[model samples]
Target: MQTVDKALKLLEFFRTDQPEIGLSDLARLAGYDKAATRRFLVALMGHAFIEQNPASRKYRLGAAFLHFAQVREATLPLATVVTPLLDALSAETGETAHASHYSAGALIAIGIRESSRANRVHLDPSEILPLHATASGLAFLAFGPAAPLEAAVDQGLRAYTAHTITDAAALRGAVAEVRRAGYAISNQGFEDEVVGIAMPFFDSSGTATGAIAVATPASRMSDELRVLILANLHKAALAATAGIGGIPAEAFVRAHGERRAA
Candidate 1:
């Protein structure tokens, strides 16, 4: 188990920005000695999970992931199902709309639709959102399983901006508010001058497995705009949840239904 954990942790070190790492850097990043890291790397290479560039002597992810991703998409087609809803949400609100999937204590951006406006918020599909510092994360914490909250607290809330909630107690309060409102609003928590409004989307088990969010520039936000965004966001969330063959919790459905009716 420890070996498997170490191997998985090593893979996570490779990201969109830092796509390659030297042997020494990999050892340092993984907190393992050079010999152990090399052994792990050799094992991974054998499975075509990691490949080394001969010229730079740096390691990068191999083609296995591409095949795996293709297989997953062919089977699940989650992004295909969610993209249209995101497009509609972005069109309605004139903001950047996105969807995230909760997996292994992380919220990963999966699909996005940027507004046609020139000054729209930008998002990277590879970004792993901080659970305490984004509307998508907050909505997941409020409506999803309890393990993610505990994991976030244990990992320590690293403040990305001055508005980020760093205190565990404060984070709990924020999550409570989300639960009550059936959605979450993040104001410059993850990035300055950006606001995110999010609604949780559930899985077949009636547990929130992901979220749909609209990100807009703070300069453009207003009470009327917020209301308009929420109204469209609820419809998008419901369609996305059902499109993915998921079941929203009764409370979630009730809250949005009442809000829309009112």
Candidate 2:
């Protein structure tokens, strides 16, 4: 198990921004000795999970993930169901709308739709969102599993901006607020000039499996716009949850109804 963990950890270093890395750099990033890193890389190469470029002598992710992703999508088809919701949300709010999936303690951006406006927020699909710093993450902490919040607190919250909640107690309070409201609002907590409004979507078990979020420029987030985004976000979240064969928690359904009535 430890060996498997080490190999997977090494592979995680490859991202959209740093797709290729040298051996020494891989060792530095993995915090493993050169010999250990090389051994892991060799094993991964044998499995076609990592490959080396002959010209740059740098390692890159191999093609195995493509096959795995295809198989997973063939079975789940989450993006197919979530993308339209994101698009509609973006269109309605005139902001960047994104969807995130939570699995094994990670919140990953799975779908995104950019607003047609010139000054809209941009998102990186490859970025792993911090649970305490993003609206999606906070919404998940409120409505999803408790284990992620415990894990995040154990790891210690890293403040991305001055508005980010760093203290565990404060984060708990923020999550509680999200639970009460059935959604989350982050005011430049993750980024300097962006605000995120997110609603968690649940799975069949009535536990949140992901979130749908709208990100807008702070300068453009007026009161009327906030209301507009929230209304549209609720509709999107409901459609997405139903499309994915999920059941929203009773509390979330109740809160959503109250918001709509108001």
Candidate 3:
């Protein structure tokens, strides 16, 4: 614990107003020896917690911070605001419905409801999925910050099941489809038994930072039903975005117009 604490303190130096810090200065600011600071930095680099400039020999915070910050947000009190939406979606669709939001670099399930149908695919509210692997992923990917979307494709798609698309080119095509359709649909990408459809939550910047989806058992829902479910989910996601001050009428119109052209 003490080692971790000291290491974290060393990181604080980078957060200082200074743009970057050399090992010696960082050590001095963090109250640690140069050798200790070096050790911490090496470990952090291994996990991509810090980035070093090759020529300058200075360190700065890395993308890992963004991922961590996002995870922290996911654990906060989002249930109260999301539960009603989850319930309504599930009740109307008769499918397992969920609300998830983007945090740092992930899609976290903040709320969920199981379908009343006799047999249905169900996802636990506590479960979180990758921002790279579901209908949820496609929805956000179609509208998230451009960098993460490219990074996700660069990281390579992990095959969750036989139906999951592993080719970057193919995935890009799917994103284009989602952009055109104003929603995303996945046929057993994460789970072979579940087909999910989702729509993005546009943020104040017009970036889709989060999404909501419904999962139905593949054996239970036909393609036409999935299409209907996606339409409903798109509406709910838009409502959620509007409630969160993420979508202005002008922004929505622009996004919709772009989709039509795409």
Candidate 4:
């Protein structure tokens, strides 16, 4: 299990901005010795999870990810159901809307619909949202499984901006607020200029599986806009939850009261 974990951990470093990485740099980032990192890389290469760049001597993600992605998309199809919701939300609020999934104890962006407005926030699919720093992650922390919350706390909170909640006690309070309000809000918590709102959703088994969010420029936030976003999000969240054969968290349903499909 440890070997498998270490091997998968290597893949986490590959992101939208840094897709390829040299062996030594990957070792440093992963905190594994060069030899162990190399061994893990070699194993992953055998399965086509990572591939070496013959010219650059760096490594990038391999074709195996494509195969796995295809299987997941075909089977789960969560993104297909959520994309329209994001599009509508983005259009309604004139803000960037995104959907994310909580998988393997981490929050990963799964889809996005960018507002055509000039000052839109952009989010890339597959980007890992920090559990302590993003509204989507905070929503999950508030309403999702306790294990993920505990795991995130154990990992230590790293502040990304001055507004980020780095203390465990403060984070708990923030999550409690989310529970009371049936959604989560982050003001410059992850990105210095962004204000975001999100609500957690569940999967077919009635387990919390993901979240949806709308982000706007911090300067654009206002009480009226906040109310609009929260109202729209409640509708979209319920629709998404139903489409996925899921249900909203009991706490959220209780806080906001259940709305039937119109």
Sort all candidates by TM-score, best to worst: 2, 1, 4, 3
Score each candidate by Cα lDDT. 0.91, 0.92, 0.77, 0.88
List model 4 lDDT by residue over 162-235, tens digit each.
Answer: 99989999988988888787889999999999999999888766566889999999999999999889888988
TM-score of candidate 1 to 2 decimals: 0.94
Better of 1 and 4 by TM-score: 1
User: What TM-score fits each model?
Assistant: 0.94, 0.97, 0.66, 0.92
A best-first ranking of the candidates according to their lDDT comes to 2, 1, 4, 3
lDDT of 2 by residue, 36-154 (tens): 99999999999889999999999999999899888988898789889888888988888999999997688998899998999989887778999999999999999998899999999
Off by over 4 Å in 1: none
Where's the lowest-lDDT run of ten residues in candidate 1? 253-262
lDDT of 3 by residue, 45-70 (tens): 88888889989989988789788767
Worst 10 residues of 4 by lDDT: 253-262
Model 2, runs deviating above 4 Å: none
49-75 per-residue lDDT for model 1 (tens digits) = 999999998999999999998999888
Whole-model lDDT, candidate 2? 0.92
Alpha-carbon error at 139 in model 3, in Å? 0.2
